[model samples]
Target: MNAPNIRPDIRFVWLNVHGGTFHKLIRLHERLRDSGLSCEVLFSVGPPRGLKLGVDVPLERVPELAARGVHFLGRTEVLNRAEKSPARLTVTDAHHDPDLPRLVRGLRARGHITAQMATLLGDFCHHGAEHLLMQHPLTLFFEMDYNHTPEGRGFAQAKTIQFTGNIFFEPTANRLVNDYPDREAFCARYGFDPARPLCLWLPNSCDARSETYGQVIEAVRGAGANLVVKLHPWEYAFKKHGGEHPWGLAATTDVLWSVQAVDETDGTWAYRFCDVAMVRGSATILELPFLEKPCVMLPLKEHVALFRAQANLVRTCCAALSDMRDLPPLLKNGPPAYSPQDYEAGRKSVRIDTTRDAYEQTMDALRQILSAPEELPVFGSLAPLRRMADPFVDASLIRTLTPSRRLRYLAARALRGICG
Candidate 1:
């Protein structure tokens, strides 16, 4: 097949992820191509992506970036006017910024399409109205929780479609099926006594107390279970959060496998491997009922509310009528302050019937807001949002410094977005 002719006109944006999101973006791109829409892809770059060269620390993609014309930009980085920003291929400048509109317009005149992935949901929603409105089809794609959108006017135009790519449940799902060290091997791997039950703790990065990992470990010990701890990747162990329990207690060698590396979804695989799971910051609370595995969630966290909400959804939506009866409540209230012996009870999640009806419903809802004879209200508002002091290019500030690295990072991220 011929490579989609690179044009200044058509531009598409893709969000990069380790798994499902990547494939889905490719699928979307393919769909656009098959429809004969002239288009180009603007790949949303992440942090320092290791390429063959020195490294692409960060760069933003542009209509004109290189001999190959693949532009690179930092992901949501804040440009400090304090220092002179880098050049166009690697940095933002008056020439590129002011000239960008002409460049994009040039690409459009050349008959190319432009699309983008909104990486940060909060910032995208709160700040990205103009950018979204600039494009024809602004899709918010993820298996995100239903509440990610604020129930107000701004959301009416953007077409939000959710696909989990199993990231949300992949960790838990992998744990359920992975070939693990037999009881003895797992014990040896993590240095727990084979005779004792292992209580595994995996916390999301932001909130320590909310994840309640400390309390879970204590509870497991209180319940007489051995411990294996996998911390949230974002938590800088050396940086003390109020002198909380020092992580010196968890011997790195004794850690079996951390969800940070092992499971990007909901940390379910990590939880499934352990006899008991203590968690904070992940949405895996809903997975336990279906897996029939036991899990503990930290209170005073948002998940505390999530669990309650899930429980209510299940109890009211599917109880008695379907197998997914108990899950809603388990997700809501959390397991009793104790262990559940069997899944024979009515509460549990059934298979995730990803069928035509569901897809239709999703599309219908999206089209209600996103469909357009001209421009969709939801997406047309995000262009100005991207032009902020920081666009989607240097979002996290990881690649904002060091011109060479930033450019490379942006290029690789853009390149990774091949339409499947």
Candidate 2:
């Protein structure tokens, strides 16, 4: 329960729709609530008509949150202009949400601070929305660590950007070190054979590039390993929008596929139990070294060029296989042996500094920001242009324009192709 007789003067609003990130947001909310701040979780399904990109519905946790004295705001009520209030602070784990700019502008219009607590750790260049959002004056971009948040890298110089440390990963690392669950017990709970070696297949949103997940699972099972599959929230988002259908696990093997069991929501339970892990292009591949676990990555044909260009550090960390035929041999030999140099490169790339406590530093930052006297945020270079464009291109109208969706997607694809 919340501390008795304490009222929150500062409010932290969590507006994340991704199931994976929602887990971290919940932990962050608890940390702040314990610190005596008023916390409200604003949950949503994701951008309408755009890529849904998230696997979980955050609004479902309302009753659970109410039981603990934390307030939960549904998406409709939160988005309704009639009932909206300028929160003292609004925070999110995702920048991909199309409505985020509107929400941020609304909060800042009334002199509130808006922050983006990034969910994944990687080169920020891979995420275009972050570049656009961080350029805004009222925004504060929180990085995984000091190295990730360098100065004058196209972000607003006047706004506050800090290496608040990795709130999600650091706590997860601490838990894995001090309070690890029993591997056998976890296996039993998930109905996996405790005796067999388990491999975790964590695929990102675009897993349908070369081969379907069913084909991948068949190859993994042929390697004499039990597999645990956790689809990225982005994949779920795509599925919800009537995208490609995911594979059924029963035909491949009695693979464990429970959302609660595999998703590191409560803590890093899945990684603790698995002997080896695999990914295509996930930041989680970068994090495995911190846990001292070996990871294997198989890049699809379509994404191979992009990965080669953007994911050099990730390649250094994991053993890259050409195809499914090569997986069994690698699995038989156990996780790859990384040199000291490889470990350093992976740590440096993701900025996983276990020396500092991210939760403490983040909470401290929040406290300081809230206690400081309020001032209206200074506008960035694009504020005038954004103000003029806001009325014309609001989210409500964009959602209703089904005729233009194809053109928008095509234009975006063409732009990306040209930029690349």
Model 1 residue 147 CA deviation (Å) reads 7.8
Error of 1 at 227 (Å): 2.2
Across residues 60-109, which tens digit of lDDT does each residue of candidate 1 receive?
Answer: 32222332323233323212110122111111111112223333334334
lDDT of 2 by residue, 229-337 (tens): 7665544444445444344322111123222225333126677677788877665775676666677877555545434433454456677777767777777767687
Clashes of 1: 82
Candidate 2 residue spans exceeding 4 A from truth = 1-10, 45-64, 67-69, 80-83, 122-154, 170-181, 212-215, 237-268, 309-311, 314-316, 322-324, 338-345, 371-420
Clashes of each: 82, 0
lDDT, residue 212, model 2 = 40
Give the TM-scores of the predictions, in the order they appear. Answer: 0.40, 0.65
TM-score of decoy 1: 0.40
